[model samples]
Target: MIENRKYIVILAFLLIGMVYAAKLFMLQVVDDTYKRRADNNAVKRVMEYPYRGVIYDRNGAKLVYNEPVYDIMVTPREVHLDDTLAFCRLMHLTKEEVITKLAEAKDYSYRKPSAFLKQVSGADFARIQDQLIEFPGFEVVPRTVRGYPHKSFANALGYIGEISPSQLEKMGKDQYSAGDYIGISGLEYQYERFLRGKRGVKYIMVDRHGINKGAFKDGKYDTTAVKGENLVCTIDLNLQQYGERLMNGKIGSIVAIEPATGEILSLVSGPSYDPNILRGREFGKNFSVLQKDSLVPLFNRGIQAMYPPGSTFKLIEALIALQEGVIHPETHIACNRAIINCHGPHSFPDLRSAITNSCNPYFVNTFKRIINQEVNPNTFIDSRIGLTKWREYQLRFGLGRQLGLDIPNEKGGFIPSPEYYDRYYGEGHWKHSTIYSLGIGQGEILVTPLQMANLAATIANRGYYVTPHLIKSIGESGQPLLEYQQKNFVGVEARHFETVVEGMADVVDHGTGQYRAKIPGLQVCGKTGTVQNPHGEDHSGFIAFAPKDNPKIAVAVYVENAGQGARAAASIASLVIEKYMLGEIKRKNIEDYALKGKFVY
Candidate 1:
């Protein structure tokens, strides 16, 4: 019995040893979780940030590029500083700032790395990089910062900054981290994903002193960042620079578009700051100064400012009237100053002459006929019906609503509807005569400079226009946006545009706009407008498209507090068109006059 008991006890002990041995073998050879955990103590994972895409003008001029910058990163658990005060002084940081940063880093992760000091210039980084080894947890990480070679187009090119908490939440933590840079506005904001590229990760083995030995596992678990795709914009750098020069000391805007393609050539909002001011460490300070300046340089006036279209809108009315058959090319309207005072005296004139002379009474009378025609016989119903139809035609022209411009925060200028009038003046209280000012492009009809430029483009195209856009092509594939390629047709028939075009041509040939807008060989079609402003002097406005047949450029210029379009806006438009077409301005005298001209309220 004793022998049997001894054998039983020995077998039980053997079974226990086998179980313990098998468990040890499984943990050491079969499962990788513990092995990875062990590797984490000796390995560090670092992110590789790719270079942001380059931005170029239509002519392939580099507008924005990236410059190498270094950021000091830290891992809290690995930190072993020889002297905290010396380290703070080396990085140009206060001891309190260093402590605060360290605490924040600990809160993020003890083992993971985080940015400690960002955007250190090359000179500063060079001075301190040799000493970084003294601080075990800290290392210099290479990154890129946006750089502008020309420093112009601040409002159009935008700037980049560290990602905000809100942006991180929206972008997803997996895609972005706290230290990532993001585009804040303009084309940068519009194409961020394509410009930012893809980030990558690399794991490297580190010794007990937190010094990188080499890539972990011979770079088996490493990735290389993909460089961002390049962008080609539609802007003409030369024309844009010239327009900016002409608009110096001005408070308005200029927008030029390629009529056939709807591609914006130059969009200048005056009183702009150099893009360089919004880059580097001084951005916040410079931005605050610009924000407080009286000129409001940050405001994008081309697509955001609302102004009455003034007499420039008369071209549309003439076309709408012609399309409705309420008027003909030969039909004459006697200019009666008693009804609506004419800017100057003129006799009975046909459609073309009326437009050339800018006869206010003729347009008022023409508007009256369209509204009071015996369609409904009931005055209120007929007026409403007519106004509704007019609004429809106006909307088709890409007015009264956002044109879906690629830029952000475009305002839809107001075009009063029947309901809008009805709310203000009761159901049957209003008539065509009540709103006669609208016929001459006043009384609640408003448009941005961009829209006005588009109107000129639509006229240049004779009936259709594509939505104006800034991007010409994206990526190496040079793919143009499909939406901008599609045409948007106005309600007016193509045939009706001929009379209006002839009238515009006549205006430049011998009418109010003649003195300032005529080019020697270019047949420029243009109209002048002196918009009434209660707060100050009239705002000068002009719209033109040059070389009447197969037009190349359509432009709109607005000059605030300028007395007449002929004085400022017309001359600027003419110079811009001439410069673009002829490549050199033969009219140096005119250019000098425009550059030095002054206007008083």
Candidate 2:
């Protein structure tokens, strides 16, 4: 009995020893997960950020570039400071700031690296880099920041800043870490994927004191970062600068497009700031100042502001009326000031004469005749049907909706429909006389300066236009964007444009716009508009294209609170057209007048 008990105890002890030895062998030799975990304690993985793409104008002038910068990175688990005060002094930080940053870093991840202090200049980094050895967990990572050589095009070029928490969750942890910078607005936001290049990694061996000894495998495992692709924008830097100068001290916007190709040449929103102010460490403070200013410099008025199209829309009405056969080129309408006010007295004028004279009564009467033309047996239904038809034609001209511009925040100006009227008034309660204000482009008709400029381009092309775009070519291959190359037809016959074109030409020859809009040798077709504003004086607006035979440029100018289109908007348009075509301003007096004029109410 005693011998049997001894054998049983020996076998149990032997089984326990074999189980322990098997487990140790699996952890130390068979599995790599534990080996990687142990190596992480002695190796530091640093990310190498690539240079962002360069932005250039159509003429290859540099718009945006990169400048050297540095970020002080920290690993929370490795932090152990003997003297906190000395470390804070070296980093130019307060003790509280250091404490808060460490807590934040630890919350992100104790094992991973995060930015402690970002966007330090090269000079500032050089001053403290030698002292970084004393701080066990901190190191300097070289990076680049965006720089603007010319400081112009603040709204168009946009700015970049540190990613927010919300953006991080959307991008995910694999693509973006905690401290990455991203494009915030404008072209930067539009082409972020092309502008932001791929990141690389480098593994380095470190000692117990957290000092980098050398590359872990002589740089065999390191990967080089790829630089971002370059962009060739459609904007003409010289023309953009000139337009900005002409619009100084004004509350307005200017959009110029190449009539043939629909390429945006220059887009200007007044009260702009220097883009340089929005870069580097001072971005937040400068941005707050810009936000609080009463002028609202950040608001992009070119594609975002909605204003009544005013008389610049009359050309559309005339074209639609002619296309629907509601009126003829020789159709005569008597101008009755009692029904609708006109600038002066006039008798029955033909379509061309009425357009040149800008007879409000004629247009109102013409609109009534078209709406009341007995298409349907029921008068109410006929009016609705006619207005619906009118709305369709208006939409074809790129009105009443977004024009699909490449830039962001474009507002599709409002164009009321029969349903819109029925919602306000009962279905059968309204008539053409009830909405006669739309005849002169006044009531409930709003348009952005970009849309109006597109309208001018459409007329210059006779019946079709290409989608307006800001990019001419992309990448090293210089491939043109094919989406903007397709033509969008307005569905109007080409013959109807001739009468309107002749009328606009006569408008520059001897009409209300002649005095301010006429160029000496080039034939300019233009229309003037004075949009009524209940708060103040009417806003001035003008749409024009020069050298009518082979048109090069179509432009629209809107001056808020100005009295008449001819006084401010027309002069500005004329000067811009002259400058673009002639390459120099022969009429220095007109330029001076436009610069010094007090048209704002």
Candidate 3:
């Protein structure tokens, strides 16, 4: 009986042992899923970034571009530098400099590739090419840095640079890394999602010499890098360049548009910088220089700046008055500056003349008539409730708010309603006398140079606009945006705009805009404004379109601290027109005088 029990126990023990052995064999020999996961840590697959999109100006002029640069990448953990002296000599740095750079690189991160030398010039790269064979892990990778064929659209084209860790934290870990370049301003910021192409991943294997082997697994797992889609802008390079030249050494902005289509022809913000300075090996140094320039070159004064629309708002008021039936085109108002204590003493024959002279009291009277609903005009918003109706009309013209333009950091110009005054004075406390400055675009009403330019474009189009885009198309052939499809606006009729146009023409003929605006062959209709501000002298403001009949171009120019519109603004805008239409400068003396001209505050 004892022998039988022992035999049974031995058999049981052998069966249990075989079961564990079988399980061990299956896990060790058959299942490799966990082992493969562990192996992944050893082979690091780095992503190779793609080239960014190219930017082109109107007529196929290249604005922003990409130039080849060499980035000296070093994996601190993997790098084996033999002779520090030799390596430093090749890289055009002292031995101690290499050690310092390597220390900094190590401080940043050792597990990943840390760029010790960024944006090495082609000349420097060539000098170090032969010496690179001595370094075990240091390698030269071809990369793209932003380039500019022209000086810049600066505040317009913007710039791109290495992404910071903060940006990575904000963006999360989808595609971008610590060293990726990204669009930082202007159109680039607005359209980054579309402009930045999809990034691809590739599995590369390296040999003993650190030379790249063919793509891992015959490129079956390799993703091809797609070049960014190019953009074609409505900006006419010639016109834009001309406008910049006109405003060179001046402080302000100019925006020009195709009247009928609202396609931007030239958009310039003064104190511009050359985009090339922010690229290449000396980018960091050059950028610092621009940053310290007394004249702000980084500000896009066109879209981002807001100033009192000045006399230009007179045209809008006239049209609004006409549409509301508060004033007829022939409504005569006597302007008596000495007697009635108004801006003018000469009696205007009609509303057309009133607008031409930009008579303050005439429009002030018209505005009061509209606000009180003195005439039986169609009611969209109730004016009897307060000056609410008139305020609504002004707001609809894209004043008092950011037009939601495609550019970055656009300003929302303020519009003060009756309620605004009510906050300070009771609703009935305010009168036409208090807000008369609003009639001539001088009061609290504000608009950006971009918005003012659009005002001209909207009038020329008779209603609809294409959202005032710098880029006309995207990708190949430049596709147009769908939301901006040509569509008419509500509010004012085409007939309402004609009298304002006539008044504007007459202003060029005999009013404050007479000098420097007359073109020998072209009919330029415009309005001039001299703003009253406590801080500084009046700013020069002018909005105009040429060839009165078939308006080809509409423009707005503003020169900050310049007292009169005709002083510099009109001449600069006219010069830009001449450059675009004539294809050559016909008025050199005029341009020279204008360029060298200065206005004291």
TM-score to true structure, per model:
0.93, 0.92, 0.88
lDDT of each: 0.89, 0.87, 0.77
Candidate 2 lDDT score relative to the true structure: 0.87
Compared with the true structure, model 1 gives a TM-score of: 0.93
RMSD of each: 3.7, 4.0, 5.1
Q: Flag clash pairs in model 3.
A: 473-478
Candidate 2: segments with Cα more than 4 A from true spot: 1-41, 208-211
Best by lDDT: 1
lDDT of 3 by residue, 1-601 (tens): 9999999999999999999999888777788766654444334365667888888887888888778888888888878876777777778798778889989888988867778898887887888887796797787777888888778577778778777888888877686877787887777776777677877877766665666655677667878778888888888987888788888888899999887666789889998888777776687899888888888787889987889887778788888888878788878976755523444446765888876677777776777676666333433233434367777777677778776667778887888877788777675566665776677777787789988888887776665455777778889865767654555373888888888777778877877677777777877888887766668877888888886788888899999888887777888877877777778878786688678857541
| Model 2 lDDT tens row, 291-352 | 99999999889988899988887898898888888899999988888897888445898999
Report the C-alpha displacement of residue 455, candidate 2, in angstroms.
Answer: 0.2
10 residues in a row with least lDDT, candidate 3: 374-383
lDDT of 3: 0.77
